[model samples]
Target: MDTKGIEQMLSVLRSTATQASGNVQESGPANAGGVDFAQVLQNSIDKVNQTQKQADQMAEKLAAGDTSQNLHEVMIALQTASVSFQEMVQVRNKLVTAYQDVMNMQV
Candidate 1:
């Protein structure tokens, strides 16, 4: 229904992630930019969460017998959201583990 909303959300998350990772320069004299990893990660996570929310809504609609949409479309959206959430979780876990490992290293 709201495909454009999804596209915008995805783009925001991408730009945010790029900025957070210090890959994109925000400050440039003429036309260059850089990304800050923190901001990027935050934005990406927010977008992913929003996507998950949308998926949840779709699922709800389907469950309520509002069969206006195809089941495959709903399922695909749900799966995509699930995978994104899981991937983000794994990334967090890895970051935490690396941090712990570094903390335990010899000074």
Candidate 2:
């Protein structure tokens, strides 16, 4: 459990939320800033994947008699990964529903 890494991740999410709400202004196009919506989404998914992998590894290590890793930390990591994944799924569902609604709209 890297506190610095967790803080950095949280900051990224906060900035992304602010940007999405139009509270933050970019000097150029999203791609130019290297922070477009697609990129942000991809980064988030990647982070979630990394977290899941880390959690899995930690669990394995703990199971293998690794005394450095604590059960509480491993459990927290697992729960965080699970919640992040669930949130990503919900976002995908919302996107799908929005797309369907748009398609069903009468011109």
Candidate 1, 20-85: lDDT as tens digits: 556985455643544445675676688789989989999899999997967999999999898888
Candidate 2 residue 23 Cα shift, in angstroms, is 18
Model 1 residue runs over 4 Å out of place are: 1-34
Reference-based lDDT, residue 22, model 2: 64
Model 2 C-alpha lDDT per residue in residues 17-64, reported as the tens digit of each score: 576556986556763744355565667678789999999999999999
Each model's lDDT comes to 0.70, 0.72
The TM-score of predicted model 2 comes to: 0.67
| Cα RMSDs, all models | 7.4, 6.4
Give each model a TM-score: 0.64, 0.67
Worst 10 residues of 2 by lDDT: 1-10
Error of 1 at 68 (Å): 2.1
